[model samples]
Target: MKSRRAILAELFLTAASLMALFPLAWMVSVSLMPPHDAVGFPPPLWPSHPTLANYRELFAHQNMGRYVLNSLIVASLATVLSLAFNVAAGYAFAKLRFAGRDRIFRGLLAALIIPGQLSMLPLFFLMKELGLLNSYGGVVVPFMASLFGIFLVRQYALGLPDEMLQAARVDGASEVQIFLKIVLPNLRPIMVTLGVFTFLSAWNDFLWPLIVLSHDQLYTLPLAVASLSREHVQDSAMVMAGAVVTTAPVLVLFLALQRHYVRGLLAGSVKG
Candidate 1:
């Protein structure tokens, strides 16, 4: 009876998992259907005749490739820059002796509770003043350094031995050498985790990019998809194709790096 019940429970969970993934499966199905077939009264589970016309139309006519490139550029730049800044600051807070370090770090932690939206208006004005509005620089600037990234790095860095740093110093290794050679290599797993997090956040960011970037040519995938959905409400297949394109890369990245990401999250939570 116990074995039977366990088997039944596993079957039930499998059904639930399929149900959760059904929307995505359906979207892909619909995206391959011929233009008008997606919204039929009795929806088709699979396209009778799968077609890549939607994807072709997206790239050729709508110039979705540009949007993809924009998303890639902004997200990658933000990830790289944020990692550099956060790791340095976090290591300093974790190991370096300095006056008021704890107090300042605490203040930063407190500030993290403040919603990013509260700064949007002022941030926009600041970007405009610096002539960064409607440019990639504007989209990438606000995310160059993040509080969460710093916190994550600091938590990870705190586990390192102080004796290692002292030894490095005794060997005449400068602080920069110590950080670049010794510390950064040890921090790789967390860095990969942070990079994935930062990339996803920047890629999916809609509101800030929407507010700052006015040019269609500069539209990121999320922005372009939203705009496309508005204008092409009738084209369900095409819209789903756009969504697939927008979501696929990030989904792939997550699936590949999820172990490291989860490890980093657990490490930060336990330590912090």
Candidate 2:
């Protein structure tokens, strides 16, 4: 009976996986289909005649490559800057002795309760004042530190043996040296998870980029895809191709880092 139940569970899981992934598969299939094939009768699941025309058009005319590059730059910058800032802040909160540190952290957590949309107008005004609007700095600056990222890191770091930091201090190690040599190595799982989260969030960001970036050249993949959709509404296959392009990088990144992400989540939750 146990063996039978195990097989049944496996079967159920397999079906659920297929159900979740079917749309992605369909999107790729449609992208490969010839023009008008994606929107054809019965909504064909597979391409009758596969062609690279949609992808070719995107690269050749739509300036998709430039958009992809823009996204890469934005995402990479956001991830690196956020990682550095959040790790330091989190470690400070977890280990350092400072007045009102807990109060300040609680204030940050309270800020998270406020809807982000409510602040956009003020944020935009602030950006304009700083002369960062319509620039890469505009997009990258706002995401460089997130409360959730800091919280995640703090939670993970809290479980790290305090003795290590004390020993490093006793040995006359500086704060920077301790963080680099001891804390960072121990926080590997959380770092990978946070890095992946930041990268994907920045890569997939559309609303902020659209609001901040006015020039066509600064358009990210999601913005470019939206433009493509409006301009080529009838070209379903082309739109699908754009979706694939916008989604593929993050998908690959997540899959590659899936183990680290899961490990980080488990460690952060269970350790502390």
Candidate 3:
């Protein structure tokens, strides 16, 4: 009976996994199919005669490489800055003692309830005032780990041993030293988790970048994909190829860090 249940669970999980991956697999299949075939009445699952012409056209005519580079640059910058800023701020909130600290942190948590979309108009206006509209800085300036990220870090940081921090303080270690030497080392797993979110969010972002980056040269991959879709409305294969290009990096990144991400979340879940 136990063996029967185990087999049933394995089958269920395998089926679910295949179900989830089917779209990506189909996208790849469609991207490789002859250009017009992907949109035909039958819509074949696998290409009858797989060809590289779509990808060739994408690179040669569309200048998609530039969009890929833009995404990498913007996402990398956002990840690093978000990790640095959020980690420090989160650690301060978790450990440091100052007046109204809890109150301020609670207010930040409360702010999460408000929808982010509601702020876009004001944010765009503020960008216009700062002379950051239609620029890389505009994208990077607003791209950072969000409120939920801060909460994640704070919850994880609270798990750090207070006695270890006290001992470091006794040894004349400055706050910066303690943060660098003690907090960061203990915080590695959660940092990887947060980095994944920050990087993926920036890479996948479209609406803000659309509002800011009016110039062709500044467009990121998602924006480029949307533009390509509009221009090549009939070319489903090309659009699918562009999607694979945009999605590949994030998938690779998440797969690489998934172990750490799981550990971090599992450990942080019980924090008070």
Candidate 2 clash total?
A: 0
Encode model 2's per-residue lDDT on 1-272: one tens digit a residue. 56988999999999999999999998898889888677754357888899999999899988988999999999999999999999999889998989999899888877867776787888899999999988888998768888778888988788988898999999999999999999999988788899988888899988888899989899999999998888877788988999999998889998999987676667446522
For 60-129, candidate 1 gives per-residue lDDT tens digits of 9999999999999999999989998999998999999899999999899888778999999999999999
lDDT of 3 by residue, 1-272 (tens): 56988999999999999999999999888889887678774367989899988889888889988888899998989989889888988888999998999999988877877887788899899999999888777897765657767888888888998999999999999999999998999999789888887788899998889988999898999999999988877788998899999998888888988886676567546433
Deviating ranges (above 4 Å) for candidate 3: 1-12, 36-42, 263-272
lDDT of 3 at 60: 89
The regions of model 2 sitting more than 4 angstroms off are 1-12, 36-43, 263-272
Worst 10 residues of 2 by lDDT: 263-272
User: Candidate 1, which ten residues in sequence have the lowest lDDT sum?
Assistant: 263-272
Q: What lDDT score belongs to each candidate, Candidate 1 first?
A: 0.89, 0.87, 0.86
**Candidates arranged by lDDT, highest first:** 1, 2, 3
Per-residue error at 253 for model 1, in Å?
Answer: 0.8
